[model samples]
Target: MALWGGLGQAATVAQLVGADVGGLISNIIQAAATARQNKKECEQLARRVLMIADLLPHLQDPEVMRRPEVRRPLTGIDDTLREAHELVTSCQGKSAAYQFVMAGRLADRFRDVQSRIDSYLLVFPFISHIDITRRLDRIYNILLSNDTAGPSSSAGSQLDVLVSQEVLVHRHGVGKFTLKELVVATNNFAQEIGRGSFGRVHKGVLPDGREVAVKSLGKASSQHGWQGLLRELDVVSCLRHKHIVHLVGCCVVRQKKSLLSFWRKNVEKQEELLLVYEYMKNGSLHDHLHGPSSSSSPSPVMASWKMRIEILLGVSRAIEYLHDYAGVIHRDIKLSNILVDSSWVPRLTDFGVVVNWDEA
Candidate 1:
């Protein structure tokens, strides 16, 4: 059997190796075909370049091609092309093999350098310090074809690995978490600390030992199968702010058992539809402002009128940051989701219900 044939079914293998090889293979093949096509294009370009060199004198006025400065550079290029043409033409037997080998190496090096230049120009005529590395990937085939002369599956595979490496690094920096890491962190969604109309919340700790509150979602009352959860997750994960609750990460995988695991409760398996967060110790403002005093405390640290006013201002500032600065609207702004820290710092929580004005 193939090493990965039934591997997708095994949770361990699926988590470690990922279940995207078929997709990656398809992408690699597509890129290779593109590179092959590009090589043909570059071959055509080579012909054109030769033609342009030959016709330079006739195409341009004598004055343009003859001026000492302008003529010198054209003459230089003409001489270089002449040398290349002679080297290519003079190949007899073994010398021809050597010339072809040298040409391939030179072309490969030129193509690599050309690929870097094209990468810079991707989002360019725009900025010098800017990088649109992913766009460069779209023309991988063309660049490879120009450089390599012909396509090889091995070369495609190599390029696939290279691109994957770069994208993976970028993803890590962008704060992507794998499925297993989320699963173990949330105690398999066992501990339900909070609940609401949209979902149940659970407490978890990250690998770094940071405590986090995870909101495990349920199917929307109107929609089936957690479709709305996904949209919310995507939006929240992209949003970054100091005042708003930081969305650490989320999980979205589709496998028969794994999908079933989320709704089911077996000790051995758990499904994941939870958003990780930085846990707040001092509960919500509703709790502090209204809930009964805790038994452990000698007496609740009741907020004076001044403290109360300060707390209200803190909440207002959080909303202002989201609405005016971040261009987001807290559609469900209320006292319950406004959490307080040990330092009495108020944090805007519960982004699940927030409305993105930009999206609207």
Candidate 2:
């Protein structure tokens, strides 16, 4: 009855909440300088950015992550950061004067977001103004790099875009999986082994010949799942033990339809959500307990009393580790959630409804 398990069913995106504040600031500063229009305004925007830049280290501080208070403000700032990045991106190919206008508008946004975060900082009193000032100074040095006014007047070109893409990769811990790669690994999702409220689960074989289970969340399920995705990802990423299921990675592709573009690229877009996990060789304990088997008779591999007690002990230990060591609660424990390996060792799985023990 010994089972090994990890407790994540469908993680929402919140677990991926960390933003490279330094990178975002760099992008905005670089873009603004290239679009040189109002030198005074550009400097003003740079100063304003000092506020958000100062908060970067604190936002990324391990202690800050431990506090739920930071999550809301951080999320708010994450939006502003993304908006600033996109605003700078959209300014590309625009006139210098237009870029200046966009930069001013974005600076105002940075100020507003910073104001909101300042209030959140009250909870983390140890994060001193001096700490922020030092980070801001570092940002100032970076912003004043000689790329001002940009080169060849095409400052908003592919080179800048490539730099931004590079920063994007550093933030995603599990590494982004391409839709094409996933297509090949899942054999076009050809092998369907189970279905659930969230979506279908397909047993897949990676390019490296490793077995995996890919769970695809339907649009409706994703809409609901987004509420808890980040927390799940955060919890599962930290959990490492012999009895827990391992999360290899995940895929979250989004698409939207558009009319014919200037280059006439395809307008069709879609949103696909997928979670990848290590394949459990022996399926779930529920299957062996009360589920169907190959021979339609009471199999000799019956749940002996000794094996049953061992299974209970294994599950208890898994729960104990999650609760005491990980500060996580296995919220949806059941027979089906306990999976098994080739050795009849039970592992825990499916953490769709987990909660931080402290919060609980």
Highest lDDT model number: 2
lDDT of 1 by residue, 1-360 (tens): 232332233332112223232232223223333342234434433343333323222212332323344323223332333333332223323344564667676466445534432342232122211122333344354434633474355654454445433332333223556668777988786777776446777888888998888776664433332534544554555556555677766544322222222122231222346566778877777877677867676223263666677777877887777777667776777777887666667777765555678676
lDDT of 1 at 154: 64
Q: Estimate every model's Cα lDDT from 0 to 1.
A: 0.50, 0.58
lDDT string for model 2 (317-344, tens) is 9999998899889787888788777776
Reference-based lDDT, residue 179, model 2 = 73
Alpha-carbon TM-score of each model against the true structure: 0.46, 0.48
Q: What stretches of model 2 exceed 4 Å from their correct place?
A: 1-172, 195-197, 254-272, 293-303
Candidate 1 residue spans exceeding 4 A from truth: 1-174, 219-227, 255-272, 294-301, 358-360
How far off is model 2, as Cα RMSD? 21.7
